[model samples]
Structure formats: C-alpha cells, structure tokens
Target: MKKSGLISVVAFIVSVIVTASSLFTASGDPFPGPVMIAICIILPIIGLLAALISNKGALKFIGFTGNLLILLLSVVVPAVSTLFWNQP
Candidate 1:
C-alpha cells in the first residue's frame, strides 16, 4: 500500500504538470497540447489504479480525490481558458 500510494502521488504530480503545460501551449496549436491533455487524463487514471491496487482506505480516498481533481483540472482549465481567450 505504501508503494502504491507513492506511485499515485508521483503520477498525480506529473499529471498536474502536464495539464499546466497543456494550458500554457493552448494558444498556438492544439496538436501536442491535445496529446499532453490526453496524458493528463491518463496519469491520474494510472494513479487511481495504483491506489486501488493498494487496497488501503486512506490511500484509496486520496487517490480518488486526486484523480478527480486532476481530471477536472485537465478538462476544466482548458475549457475555461478557451472561453476567456479573446477577452483580453
């Protein structure tokens, strides 16, 4: 469980970085950005899976919440930025 929880934390952090970078690159083109966003989705799911495999209560809760936030940020941040992109 400890090992799995550690993996989850690492994946979650990487996911966040990927999501932020995706947003940072949103202005020019959407090619690599989209790919990174896909990664953003993938990493958290990986984390969640690791956590589930651990089968510990606290890690499970943390994993679920972190996974949800990572997924939410990946999608919501891009959408919100796009919506306000032209506002200046």
Candidate 2:
C-alpha cells in the first residue's frame, strides 16, 4: 500500500475504536456533540496545513492519517449520536 493508503486505513481503524468506546461512556448529556464537531472540523484543516508545511513523505503520511481519522470520527460520532438519541 502507498503511504497515504496505509495512513488512511490506520486512521479509520483507530477512529472507529475510539468512537465506539466513547459512545458507551456517559456524563449527564452523554454526547459531547459540539466538541466532537469542532475536532472533526479542525483536524482536517490542521492536516492540510501540515501537508503544506512539510516536504517529507512521513509528514504527508501523518497529515493524511490525521485527516482520515477526523473524517471517520465526524461521520461515525454523529450517526451514533442520532441513533441513540432517536431510540424509543
């Protein structure tokens, strides 16, 4: 696999694990909705900035991985939140 592909896969897997575990933990509201949203939004931007700043392949991998993880978290967290919130 290319570096980018490897990074993306690792990021996806990590994000899935983190997101799943987070869903089970509760503190009053259970979901830290806005915080998750901000992370999702900010990570990609930071990744892009890293990509722009670095000339090394490893840095590129890191940025891509970060972006991928953020994207996965963005989708999974909201979906999970909706499912739990809407349950009857």
Candidate 3:
C-alpha cells in the first residue's frame, strides 16, 4: 500500500482501539471522547480516498467523491451519537 493507505490503516486501527477502550471505561478520564469519534469517522473514508487515488484510471475521481460523501455522512451521523454515548 502507499503512504496515504498506510496512514489511513493505522489511523483506523488506532481509532478502533480508542473506541473500545473508551467504551469499556467510564468518563472523567484524562483523555476525551470526541477526538476518538472524529478519528473513527474520518480514517476509513481517508483510506477509501487513498485507495481510489492510487487506482490507474477510470473511476478514480468518482471513488474519491463517493468516499467524500461517505465521510460527510459519517461525520454528520456520528456527531450527536458520541455526545450522548459518552454521557451517562
């Protein structure tokens, strides 16, 4: 995979670990939850974009735009969810 792909993958894995850790534990810890939510929402979309850009031709642009849409939707949908989730 390319650099961007590698970054996206790492970001995604980190996001997952953060999410699991955050979920199992209670609030009032040193770290914040929104940041983790942001990571989880953004990284896979980034990975998709990176993979699309690396493609030879044809649907590269389309794939990027599609991923962007996914990104936007992911952000919008989860923005509220994390807020409620982190709270009791």
Candidate 4:
C-alpha cells in the first residue's frame, strides 16, 4: 500500500480505539449506552472519511480537527452540561 493509504488506515484505527476507550472508561458505565455507543461508532468513521478526503498531505489538518472536536465534545460538552444539570 502507498503511504497515504497506510496513514489513513492508521488514523482510522487510532480514532476508533480512542473513541472506544473513552466511551468505555466512564465511571458509571460498564458499556456505553445507546447514544454514547452511536457517537463512538460514528465519530471514528467521520474521522476516517476526513482523513481520506484530505489525503496524507493534510493528515495533520484532519487530526487537528478531530482532536478539536473530541476536546469540545469531551470537555466543553460536559462542563456545559454540568452547568445546566446542576444549576442553582
């Protein structure tokens, strides 16, 4: 396989693993419930698509976007959720 193909495959695998780990690591969860399961399943596919579309030359750009999205969803989403759910 070409370098780009290898990179894309690696990116897809890494993204899927990270997503799975995060979903499975939540304190109260043995398995991710339906919604989390869906997100975990979908996000890596999206990341793979992004990586494929951008080509290996733009892998960094695709990675940055993926990381940013993960950070936003994992950090910002929970903080905002806490504010609303735990409001005075």
Candidate 5:
C-alpha cells in the first residue's frame, strides 16, 4: 500500500503539472483539460484512501492535505480562472 500510494502521489503531481501547464501553451485547448484534471483528482484521492486504510501514520493526513491542494490547484483554480474570470 505504501508503494502504491507513493506511485499514485507521483502520478497525481505529474498529471497536475502537465494538465495545468497546458493552459499556458500556444496550442491550448479546453477539450482535454477537464479530463486530465479529473485524472489528477483521482490519482491523489486513491493515494489518500490507501494511506488511510494502511495505517501509515503521518502519510494519511499528509496525503489527504496534499491531494486537496492538488485538486484545488489543478482543477478549481484553472476552472474558475477560465470559466468565471475572463483572464487569459
């Protein structure tokens, strides 16, 4: 579970960076952002859940907090920035 949780955390961070950074590219498209954001949310969530189930002490709380940050950063911020505020 620890190994799997670590893997999920890495995947989640990478996906979040890739997905969020895509917004700044010249070829940016809205088509893939939501899907990738969904992936980012899922990966960290899985890690958090696994950590909780495995009784890994600090890992569980840290995983949850980190996952929440990832979710906000990779999903909510981009979404609000694009959909609500008209900023480029």
Candidate 6:
C-alpha cells in the first residue's frame, strides 16, 4: 500500500481504538465525560476525512467502517445509555 493509504488505515484504527476506549472509560465526573465526548467526535472525523481523501478502495472502506463504528460508540451508544441508564 501507498503511504497515504497506510496513513488512512492507521488513522482509522487509532481513531476507533481511542474513541472506544474513551467511551468505555467514562466516569461520573462531569469533566471527563465531555472530554471523552470531544475525543470520540474529533478522532473519527479525522479518520473519516483521511479516508475520504484517500485514493485506495480498501483504505476508504476501512476508514468509513471505523468512522461508523466511532459514530455508534460516540453518539448512539451514549444516547441509548442516557435513555436507559441515567442515574439522576
């Protein structure tokens, strides 16, 4: 694979891992939640953009998949959790 493709793949992998870890690591503290949310959103965007700009088909697929997973982890999962698990 080319350098750009490799970068895209790396970005996709790293973003997914970081986003997922942040989501799972969330605590009751107000500060960490927002910070994790920001990390979850930003990293996926970077991965998605990197994927969109790539010239390789496989890399694009990997990137988009990672972005979608991140979206679910960062947005949908939290919303569901809040709907069902909010402790207040």
* Candidate 4 local lDDT, 1-88, one digit each (tens): 2354445545555655666576677575444577554454455555556555554455645554564566466557878889889655
Candidate 5 root-mean-square deviation in Å: 4.1
Badly placed stretches (over 4 Å) of model 6 are 1-4, 20-35, 80-88
Candidate 6: what lDDT? 0.68
Instruction: Pick the winner on lDDT between candidates 3 and 5.
Output: 5
Query: TM-score of each candidate?
Result: 0.61, 0.43, 0.45, 0.42, 0.53, 0.61
Q: Model-by-model lDDT, in order?
A: 0.75, 0.55, 0.55, 0.56, 0.64, 0.68
For the record, the alpha-carbon RMSD of candidate 1 to the native fold, in angstroms, is: 4.5
In the range 1-88, model 1's lDDT, one tens digit per residue, is 6788878878877777666665678574334755765678777888888888876677677776788798787667778899889966
Instruction: Report the Cα lDDT for residue 72, model 4.
Output: 67
Clashing pairs in 3: none
In the predicted model 5, the residue pairs found to clash are none
lDDT of 2 by residue, 1-88 (tens): 2444444434444544555566566753234877554444553555555455555576566666666666666666768888889655
Candidate 6, residue 62: the lDDT equals 80
lDDT of 4 at 81: 88
The runs of at least 3 residues in candidate 2 whose Cα sits more than 4 Å from the true structure, single-residue gaps closed, are 1-31, 72-88
Clashes of each: 0, 0, 0, 0, 0, 0
Clashing pairs in 2: none
Give the Å shift of residue 79 in candidate 4. Answer: 0.7
Error of 4 at 46 (Å): 21
Query: Model 6 over residues 1-88: C-alpha lDDT tens digits?
Result: 3555566667667666665565466563234666656657776777677777778687788877878777787678878898898577
